[model samples]
Target: MNKINELSYNIKIRNTLYFEAAIGLSGNSFLLLFQVFKFIRGQRPRLTDPPIILLALIHLLMLLVMSLVASDIFMPGKRWSDSTCKFVMFLYRFFRSLSLCATSLLSILQAITLSPRNSCLAKFKHKSPYHMLGCLLFLSIFYSSISSPLIKYIAAIPNLTSPGFIYITQSCCLVPISYSVWNTFYTLFTLRDVIFVGLMAISSAYMVTFLYRHKKQSQFLHSTNRSLKSSPEHRATQSILCLMSFFVVMYTLDSVISYLRNPSNDPIFYFIVILVGHSYASVSPFLVLSTEKHVIHILKCYGRTVDI
Candidate 1:
């Protein structure tokens, strides 16, 4: 009965991972396609659209690679080649880093968009698409350099697995590094995370303050109107604020779970951390879609097309 229960537990975790992947993939696909369609139709893209598109693409690829990684973890009978393990793990790390970069860019872009003309952020309002993309490209290279060390560490587990090998998946494990090298990489990773997350937090706070001040000024200017609806900028700012908040929450939760599980051998904590780490990517597209009237219109058009 213990064996049977353990088997069932593994199956449940595997199914849940797959389900999350499916939802993430579908939502991101729609988002990507719609954004591309808008660009193709010669519609002037919003400042936030570029980062949103990049983010969706990153999340889509991340989910695809994660699903592949999940198979290696949950399927005990399956094995991956050393080269395959290295390649998949590298892609996952690269895309995960890009996802953070893109999200940070999105939040910053939105904050700039909402900034008043007299504000310091207004200077960035006229930045060309090429400029924004260049920033993303630079950050991508920076993160790729930082994350490249993982390629050297990840390999297929040999038959003579040592206690030093930390399991990343059923077929792949991280070879232990020296204490000095480990601390160096750890510091780099921590610095990268702090910079991006700090940018997100600061941008989020700026948006909140901007919105509140704007609201108060508007109320004072129009004392008779109690039913002043939020403008499009306000709505969009609120949406991105929600997205950033959710991302930070998921990040913190994953970090806590990871720290707690580091000294233990509990598969439950391991699976929970994986789920938590991907939760932002899986759920963010739906959150954005729910806030966009254009996305709603796109869905309605699809419904009409189906009906016809």
Candidate 2:
């Protein structure tokens, strides 16, 4: 009786929490898509920092797909075929690594974009956008391929839960991956996350510090005029901070929680952690839309048309 109650509780946690989070993720991801379209299709269709929002929307779509796979995996007696399991695991790892790399790219690009004259990144400021796009594509596809081996962790199990429902319960969950491989995964991925997080932190700090100093230097030019000057760059810095807060900080927590979870011992925290992992996709778009005036203008235009 106690075991059944516990299992039921775990199932409820998986379903309810995941459903709620999924709803938010699905809605916000579509909102981002709509906003992006509005900006691109509006009268003056010049996107500001196109790469950042583009990558974010891609990450959001991937998150929505991953959430659905997670829903399947959490089913108590469900069993997956070898190929099905492999694909799901592969996509999950691939998308996550892609998100991390995209975020790091956003930070580094912003750093280069905002660097002052004679700064170290100034030389690369005029780097070809075509080359940058190629590199990002390679990173998202080729670099992320390294996680393909993780599919070995997934295995199929029989439906021993209920004799009556044997026909319906078709798939199984991942057995605890081997301790050595699992630990190695944790160590290696943790190092990867740390490296990217550090890069983003340093880049964001440099941008914000440069902008603040630039504002202060304005005061020196005219001693009697002490007001801080506002610039588009200042707004860019704020947007970058908002984007980083969502991607870097929330991502670190999600990664740590995912690494430490013991699915057999506790399924609740796993669901909760997974929820946090996807929330970045759902919430980050609001930041992007709010920070970019053009997108809001388009939204307002659309709203007015609707009102009429």
Point to the candidate with the largest TM-score. 1
My TM-score estimates for the predictions, one after another, are: 0.90, 0.76
**Residue lDDT tens for model 2, 1-308:** 99888767767766765675566566556555765676567733222354565566666666666556656646544456767766766676777777777777777787777787888877877766445666667767654655565567565554454322211112545555667987887676667667778888998888778766876777767653223333545566677778897787787787677667553534555666667877776666667557566666778999999999
In model 2, which runs have C-alpha deviations exceeding 4 angstroms? 1-50, 73-78, 128-130, 141-145, 158-172, 176-178, 222-230, 297-308
Write model 1 residue lDDT over 1-308, tens digit each, in one string.
99888778888888899999999999999889888888889988788988888889899999999888776676567688999899988998898889888889899999999888998989998987547988998988887898797689989999998989888888888898889998888798899889999999999999989877877887888753243343566667878999998999998998787667663445676678778889999999888877776777878999999999
Q: What local distance difference test score does each model get?
A: 0.85, 0.64
Tell me the deviation in Å of residue 303 in model 1. Answer: 11
Model 1 CA lDDT for position 218: 78
Model 1's alpha-carbon lDDT is: 0.85
lDDT of 1 at 202: 95
- Cα deviation at 198, candidate 2, in Å, is 1.9
Instruction: Find the number of clashing residue pairs for candidate 1.
Output: 0
